[model samples]
Target: MGGAMAVRVAAAGHTLTVFNRTRAAAEAVATRCPVDVTVAGTAREAAAAADVVVVSLADDAAARATYGGSDGLVAGLAAGAVVADTSTVAPETTRALEADVRSAGGLLADTPVSGSVSSVEGGTVLVMAGGSAEAVERAAPALESFAQRIIHLGPLGSGATMKLAVNAMVFGLNQTLAEALVLAEKSGVARELAYEVIANSAVAAPFVHYKRAAFEHPESAPVAFALDLVAKDLDLATALATQVGAPVPQVELNRRIVGDAIAAGRGAEDLSALAEHLRG
Candidate 1:
């Protein structure tokens, strides 16, 4: 996702320096754009030199590890540099990171993206951001290059909260789709016929519509968003619910189902592979 965003930004005439734990991955991303792409040896090196530094790591632990230490972005960034975090981290972590960036005389913006690889490649992702109006305005043009819809939710950590809420719905819907397909197949209905019927129904959605091929083949192409990542997002959603004292029973259930799937060694598969469990 970060690589795709960087590609879009660079294509839009913004220079970018990328840092990844794997140098090859960073180089691979940089090779796609005709920009002054500096492959940094560490996060700090990348952050120190960039005007607007974007961190797009896996989770909170990874985000913190990339910025919390002396060699992290926080220590190496110039004063007044804008730090845009694109990682899906906890709201508290976003708040803390924002404070830390401010303490260092830098600004932080929490901007989480929503889309699959295809959507990102097409520059149609939805971006929800939370930060100061000035910071958001500063980042808007660059963000606009990659997002079809960019909404400023509120201040500081609202983007993270909004992202969690959105993922909760996605997780639930994916699970519901899996169960529905499983039930239909078990009832001796042809998978293709079931999909045709559902695709014409009111319940048919973009999610189900897109996954129809996967439902038919079961073992289709490589997974774009792996089940482990889905599980991680669900875990984040569940944690967010608990932090805000909201009872998300449905989210909790979906978390367990994804968790069980991951534990069963299906973590690397597409989230739609949840149908395999339902087939049992």
Candidate 2:
């Protein structure tokens, strides 16, 4: 996802520099773009070179690691720089990171995005941005590089909150769709035909349209969103729900189903593989 976003940013004529824990991964991103992308050895080096730095790490832990150390991105940031963090983490994590960036004379926006690789490639992902209007506006050009739409939710961690809400729906839909598909198959309905009806029905969301190949041929389709990541997102969602005194019983159930699939060693499979997990 990070690599795809880099390609989109570069395609938008932004001067881009990439840094990944794995040098080869950074190199791969550079190779994908026709423009010159400087491959930096450290997060600090990359952050120092840009006024607006967009971060897309794996999770909260990775986000902390990239922004916390003495030679971190915050340390290398020029004064008044804007940092857009696109990782899906708890609101608390973003709040803490925002403080760190603010202390360093920089602005941080919790700009978690919603979309898959195709959306990134096409520069059509939805960005849920949370920050002061000034900070979010400062980061708009870079965010606009890869986002089709950007919604400024509110201050601090609002983007994370909205992202979790969106994922809660996505995960619940995934589980219900899996069950519906498996139920149809077991009840003598053809798998493809059932999917056809589902896709054409009122529930034919963008996720369903893009995920058709994965659901129809779980074994052959590339993993768009891994189950392990889905579990992680579910954990964030449930934790947020608890923090705000909200009830997410459906997400809680989806978490258990995802946990069971992970325990069975299908953690690395696509989320659509939930259908196969249910078939067994």
Candidate 3:
């Protein structure tokens, strides 16, 4: 996903210097784009050279690793540099990261995006950005190259919070859809008829429509979103719920189901693999 976003940014004519823990993967991504991307040896080197630095790590710990340390991105940021963090984490953590950037005379914008790899490649992903209006505006031209909708939600960590909220609905719906399909198939209803009915039902979401192929062919559905990532997002969601004293019984149940999916070693599979998990 980071690689794809880089391609999009470069395509938009933004000069890019990419950093990755694995140099080969970064080079592989560079090869996919016609734009010449500078390959930096260290995060500091990359952040030092760019006015707008985007960090697209997988989790909070990874985000800190990418942005922390004495020689990390924050260590070498130039004044007025805008650091865009594209990770799903706790709002408080993002705010803390923002403080680090601010101390270095730079800004941190928490930009958690939603959509599949295709959406990213096609420059149609929804970006939930959080930070000062000025910083978001400064990053807008670059963000517009990769996102269809750029929403500046609020101060630091708003994007992360919004992403968690959105994932709750997304994963919950996915789990429910899987269970519905499992129930229908086991109760003598033809799988085709069940899908046909559900696809046309009022409860059907665009996501359900998109995963129709996965529903029919769980073994072959392209992995747009993996189950392990779903579990991560759910973990963030549950934590957020607890912090706010909100009860999310359904989300809690879905989290356990995702844990089951992970325990079955389906973590690397497409999230639609839940149906296959449920079938077993």
Q: Each prediction's Cα lDDT score?
A: 0.84, 0.92, 0.88
Please give the TM-score that candidate 1 achieves against the real structure.
Answer: 0.92
Estimate, for each residue in 1-280, the C-alpha lDDT of model 3 and write its tens digit. 8888999999988899988988898889889877898998888899999999988887888878878897699988999999888777888889888888999999889988987677789888899999999889988888888899999999888999999999899998898899999899999998878998999998788777778888888877888788888898888889999999999998899989999989989999998999999899
lDDT of 1 at 252: 86
User: TM-score: which is higher, 1 or 2?
Assistant: 2
**TM-score-based ranking, best first?**
2, 3, 1
Tens-digit lDDT track for model 2 on 9-118?
Answer: 89889999999988899998999997988999999999999899999988899999999897689988989899999999999999999888899899999999998889
Q: Residue 264, candidate 3: how far off, in angstroms?
A: 1.9
Candidate 3 TM-score over all chains jointly: 0.93
Rank list by lDDT: 2, 3, 1
Looking at model 3, how many pairs of residues clash?
A: 0
**Which window of 10 residues has the lowest lDDT sum in candidate 3?**
202-211
Give the number of the best model, judged by TM-score: 2
Cα error, candidate 3, residue 114 (Å): 1.7
Candidate 1: C-alpha lDDT: 0.84
Q: Between 1 and 2, whose lDDT is larger?
A: 2
Clashing pairs in 3: none
Could you tell me how far off, in angstroms, the CA of residue 29 lies in candidate 2 after the best superposition? 0.7
